[model samples]
Target chain A: MTPFELIVREHGPTVLRVCRAVLTAHDAKDAWSETFLSALQAYPRLGADANIEAWLVTIAKRKAIDVIRTRARTPVPVGDVPDGASELGIPDDERGEVWALIGALPDKQRKCVAYHYLVGLPHSEVAAIVGGTTDAARRAAADGVAALRRAYATIPGGTA
Target chain B: MTNIEAPNTADLDRLHDRLVHAADEAGLLDLAYRTVDTPIGRLLLAATDRGVVRVAFETEGHDRVLGDLAARVSPRILNTPKRLDTLARELDEYFAGQRLGFDVPIDFALSRGFRRDVLGHLAVIPYGTTESYAQVAVATGNPRAVRAVGTACATNPLPIVIPCHRVVRTDGSLGGYLGGLHVKRTLLDLEAAA
Candidate 1:
């Protein structure tokens, strides 16, 4: 196997995880693909003894930042919401009421919750990805979670 | 309630699972696989109709996995979660020492030429044995290609599955693992324990 493939095979997960933590899930996939492609193109120039995992993370980080920057320029329209509480294709009318509360969060808080919970990144890593300190990342994640709990409480069957 | 907010970690985790399940049912994702609860957080084993497309760490959700499958296979992407059930069983058995090697098909389209050569040889390194980069260079028909072998090992897109962890330094030290050394050690220890 080529050394690069070995590196990708070995570290694909790390790169994927970092990207997911840093970028939105929708954007994380794009960044992941770009990370490998960029690495492949830049491989010949990298020092032979360089840390491959670190290099891949750097690539993923840069790609994710670029995505955030690009998206920040022109906001994309979200999919249509059918009702005040039933937009995300919930099969049951009851379930949509609960999800609507979660979806009501600001983009930043939503991303933070997704990264902290779904991506399972530690505070330091999430901070690095989000261009903040470890403490700030943790706070943002906590606040986001707390907000969700409060929002859910407003619903009939919602519990914090 | 005066204020509403985002989901909490526990809530997000539950939602993540539900989203993945929904994606499975809706066929929204072209690849579907489970994240095995291992020493690592969760080892994701994902595959498409063509073959095994990706094996990821479970940090990313369905979005990440589906996006990867879309980019790699493009039009050929077809989510076949059931096909990977066998792989999951084998991986479980392999970790348990009941299985020697994987028999499932792999789509090596993610790699090519020299890289493919390196991992193909790395895969044959045997479960209990280790090979050095220089040794792999000799096996690849170019003794001076030790650096090339290291490069191959470094770039391998599939780690434990391709067994790149079985490759070591010529000086007989543990090499790097993208999944981190702890994971590499666990795999090595699993083989040793076997």
Candidate 2:
């Protein structure tokens, strides 16, 4: 059996990206950890020849859904400031805005982009995780990316 | 697709370590483990819900050790070392000459029969004393288990903690250790100097 440590080192960054694509940086970080913890616990039973990336992405999607549920459960803060309309720098503000843009996509397309584009899953595998056919998964990702382009070009450095 | 640069993930490395703590707090990690650098070499430290389960040498093959654990113990194991904090600290202290005996609980679920009985006697051999395999066999109530005692020490899962290094040849020479003769000699000398 492959040592679980190797799995964590090898796929940790990609899994983090998957989590970040679907949730906030902070929440994504937590989800990533939970995914690995769950993965490690289940690693022994994970078929030796299983597609590891697809398995990990499936866990990430489940974890991302949990993150949304946790946020929904918490009492909302009074006067949580609305997002400011401002040009963003590449370092900090740009990333936040980019996440906001991607997060705004419809659920199916958002997952398609997250799993396919960001996490780099093939359309076939992405479909398996997102629950659709390969053609549908690819189209959702294409439409999601196109939407990202149009909406992003309206904001300074959005496309960048 | 629009080019979205992979955001700087330098934070993820730090976050991975922190997340282990969070995972532990949330009761997610079933078996926690980490690799520790010691005088001998990098040792793989693994623990179960009961206590520390496996301490492995590099040459013993960490992957093989973990595989055995995954099969024998629960498959739900993670590399979260927080559960082994005390064991790690005690090991560090032992190496530093500040501790005489291990104060950590150990789980021997992976061993059975004569091997388990042999390992149980291996523990109380004291810090600086050496016992011949024949003596150990006799002590364990199986005088003919001399070779069995040797095999038991050679396959010891938690070597340093259980003090298998204290077992020697009947001729008063070091026989063999799972961590190799050099490691056995090193531990023996370390105790002698202390």
Candidate 3:
């Protein structure tokens, strides 16, 4: 069996992308941690033939929904607004803007794009997590990326 | 884009640190381990909440060691070197001959009964000193358990840190070691040379 550290380093950033594409970068941190921790707990049972990235993405999506539910219930303090995320040393996060754009897409479409485009998983696996047919996952991802192209073009330094 | 750069490299390292801290706080982390390259070979170091639990030689198969630990301890193992940071530093210093003894606490949970007792005796054998297996068995109050002492040395889970390599034959010949004879000789030479 591979060490959990290798799993984290090899796919940490990808999982973070999946988290960011699912939630805001700030909330993504929590989802990312929860994903790996939950993975670590169940790592012994993870089958030898398992597709690790797909398994982690599924957990991340589940964790993202959990984070979303928690955020919906908790009332936020206006003074603690997270607009100035960069000021808190979030680092080189011009991608946060890109993630924010991706986060704007409808839930299913956003996740589809994140898994397929960001993580490079096939539509079949993406569909397995998002609960849809392969065609729908591909279409949702295509539409999501098209929407990103539109939104990104408006950003100050976008490649669109 | 073939090259996706979403989470920056610096943030990932920072994130790994956060994961270790968070996992540790939740008490979900059971074994925090890391591999260190040594003069003899790469060593796999692991720790529990109690103390350093395992020190494995490269020939011992690091992956196999973690599998055994998962079965014996909790299955929650992560490669969090922060837990073994001081041990690794001390080991490096020891190999460099700057440190005489390891200050890290070791957990002898893997071995039990006579083996554990033998290892406890082995710990105090002192650096640069070699004791015959028969001598160690006598020191542990089981002079007739010479064969048992050899078994303990062969199966010692803590190896170098516990100083199992210090045990030799009664005729002053090097006995077998869990890390192979060459590694045993190298460790002995390291201390003797120091």
DockQ of each: 0.03, 0.36, 0.40
**Mind giving the per-residue lDDT tens digits that candidate 2 earns over A18-120?**
7766666667777888798778667767887998878888888788788778898641221122555321212354455666677677878888998888777
Q: Candidate 1 lDDT, tens digit per residue, B143-190?
A: 898887877876666666888888888787787766777777788888
Per-residue C-alpha lDDT of model 2 across residues B30-78, encoded as one tens digit per residue = 6789888888899899987788889999998887887777677755556
Give the higher-TM-score candidate: 1 or 3: 3
In angstroms, give how far residue B134 of model 3 lies from its true place. Answer: 2.8
Which of the two, 1 or 2, has more DockQ? 2
Return whichever of 2 and 3 wins on DockQ. 3
Query: Which regions of candidate 3 fall more than 4 Å away from where they truly are?
Result: A44-51, A70-101, A148-160, B1-3, B36-42, B59-64, B96-100, B138-148, B180-182
Return the TM-score for candidate 1, rounded to 2 decimals: 0.46
Clash counts for the predictions, in order: 31, 1, 0
Q: How high is each candidate's TM-score?
A: 0.46, 0.80, 0.80
Q: What would the per-residue lDDT of candidate 3 be over residues A1-160, giving only the tens digit for each residue?
A: 6667768878898898887766655777888988998898788788989999989988998898898888886411122225665322245654555655665677788778888998999999889889979999999999988888887788687777
Give the candidate number with the greatest DockQ. Answer: 3
DockQ of 3: 0.40
Compose the digit string of candidate 1's lDDT tens values, residues A38-60.
66556646775876665677677
What is the model-wide C-alpha lDDT for candidate 2? 0.79
TM-score of chain B of each: 0.74, 0.90, 0.92
